[model samples]
Target: MHPHDKGKDRLRKFVARSEPAHPKLPLVHSTDAYTFTDALEDGNLEPRDCDVFIGEALIYTFYGRPSYRPNMNESATSLDHYLPVCLILKLSFAQDLKRIFPFDTGAFANDYYSTFMHRRMGLGDFALEADLDTPGRVITTFFGSARNYLHAAPDTKTQFDPAQFEARSYAALIDAKNSNAMDSRGSGIEIQIADPISISNWVEAAVVPSTFVQSETGDALRRLNIEILPYNVHSRMKPNEYMSTVTDACLTYYAQKGML
Candidate 1:
């Protein structure tokens, strides 16, 4: 991913944070969604915000690959819908700063200047190198679609049609993309997406029927309907924060962009 495209300097650092923070992810590309996602769950990893950014990038990497037409949706925006994922990553970064640095400025503080540079980089200094060498085809396709924005139908910023894009659940999306395959050797990709607030109760949700929890969705996941715990992450918090942080941060970041 280009440094210009990444949201902000501070935010980009979080995305560059090594997955599992140990195995050293071998400079994978943002498009390698399955491999990258599988790693997040692999080992003792305290991922920073950048990990989630990588997650967002992995999903978006498919956007302009070969043809952004496959990536089209109702909106004309490129990766516009992914703002939620973006914001969530940033919030996690903010949280990390709070715990370790503990901002001297009040909660209202917003500037990157909040950081007091030291001899060495502080906790939030993340790198912004593109993990995967996103294929030229993908990059060209993504931009090509965006270039046709003006030719789109009313309110449509993109020229691609989204018949297959809408009206699909997460399960259907992954299955159609052939990303849902799981190997017995603890391989394949597991995309963990759900309401973060409800995640803490996932274990208990398993025991409690939807009748008790009042969630048909919960019942479905608990039973054979779908894999309740997708993804490799054992810690509920890991995926939970990943889901929440990206959703929240992207919303705010884009909303601010809209204003500008």
Candidate 2:
């Protein structure tokens, strides 16, 4: 095989082995009601400059339950206060699209090294043929949180050797023996996709708060044939502890405006 073909073949196998057990696991993209409505009307999920993370759309995958859940960490306030929803993208479709790549940690965190890497190697760059030649240099899926590795001091800690990094799917974080990892909300992994994803072509379903189930937005979702999942089913859909107060304030504001 040609060198380029060999590299591509290896990369494809790597991604396949890394995937979660389910063949059709969906990726979750959290958003507010207004933005979701816009996407439905436009039939696309266009990345806004203000919301872009390293010049691509951000989404999350899970190692636990298969149902849809709201990611409260997506914002500083209660996601429900903003009439939050989640766009469910098919993982198979995203992988087939070839513009999607996974980061072993939350890409938006304040880790300096991770930030530098994101800037230096945009999502697409990590998957390039040249980068694939040395996959560990471009990708590393940690046994635990990558933060543990980043925060360890060089002299006192085990060094991270790029050549020794093992690339695994975010789903691999969970195993029958690791109850703690299984109980966590998510794998802390981030999946980045190239911009302007077509909603009609990519989105498989949506999760909306119960409040919006009868609203105009719900009607629009049905019209588009996107399955509507209520968020209350999943425990993790609740706002984080720190955001409870902020979420309450947002709820009040929305209620005062007669939006609730």
Candidate 3:
């Protein structure tokens, strides 16, 4: 067998015996209310220009909570100024889509900051140049939030080997305990979906702040037949603070797993 085939076979066996992380968790895509309203009007969630992944829509599998907040420290003129709308999508929605992939950390940071800096430095395409297959990306979901196990180097400061697919797969499967180490609110783990995701059949609900319930956007949301769940954003951790907490959690998880 070819060396690459051997690696894939090993990954297959590893995945067969691995415990999958929160497979049933509702994936949340947080956006500004204006964007959410536009999606509702269009009957689909269109991909925005992401600095890392280019033309892809991002969703966070943050266990049961929303992981994104836009300018949490800044006061908004209205609830909609910050990313106040959370579109909850079923995990199974991927089954109906093409080119859905999972990443252990935010894809842009994973590649731009850690993996292919040269590309970001005007040497090549800004998008990740990793030759990652869909199956390998799928395996990442099994070890979601356990960021350390999903990379050749655990520390974000270190450069990552884009070709070390087998190593990452092996590392994740070897430590099943960290598969669900998702206590941090901002786990930074994300899923990238191909552009123009039709949300009419996929999104289960839209969660927004209670103040938005009577807003114009709320009326528009109700017209779309999507359940609008009112949530308290003030009770949640600030996004900037969550960044620090996420870094600490990653280090703590790595230490607990003896990978630090």
What tens digits encode model 3's per-residue C-alpha lDDT throughout 62-126?
A: 32334445455654343344545667665456533222222334422434233322332221211
Decreasing TM-score order of the candidates: 3, 2, 1
Query: What is the C-alpha local distance difference test score of candidate 1?
Result: 0.21
**Considering every candidate listed, which one attains the maximal lDDT?**
3
lDDT agreement of model 2 with the native: 0.41
- Report the lDDT of model 1 for residue 134: 20
Report the error of model 2 at residue 217, Å.
0.6
So what's the TM-score on candidate 2?
0.48
> lDDT per prediction?
0.21, 0.41, 0.44
Model 1: residues with Cα > 4 Å off, grouped in runs: 4-113, 118-212, 224-260
Across 21-137, the per-residue lDDT of candidate 1 in tens digits comes to: 111111101211222223223411123233333333222111111111111122332221111111012111111111111111111022222122223332233222333322122
In model 2, the Cα lDDT at residue 215 comes to 78
Off by over 4 Å in 3: 1-23, 55-65, 71-79, 91-188, 233-260
> Tens digits of per-residue lDDT for model 2 on 129-199?
22121222222323322222122111222233343222222223222233422323222224434457777
Clashing pairs in 3: none
Q: Write the number of the candidate with greater TM-score, choosing between 1 and 3.
A: 3
Which prediction has more favorable TM-score, 1 or 2?
2
**Model 1 compared with the native: what TM-score?**
0.18
| Model 3 residue 117 lDDT score | 28
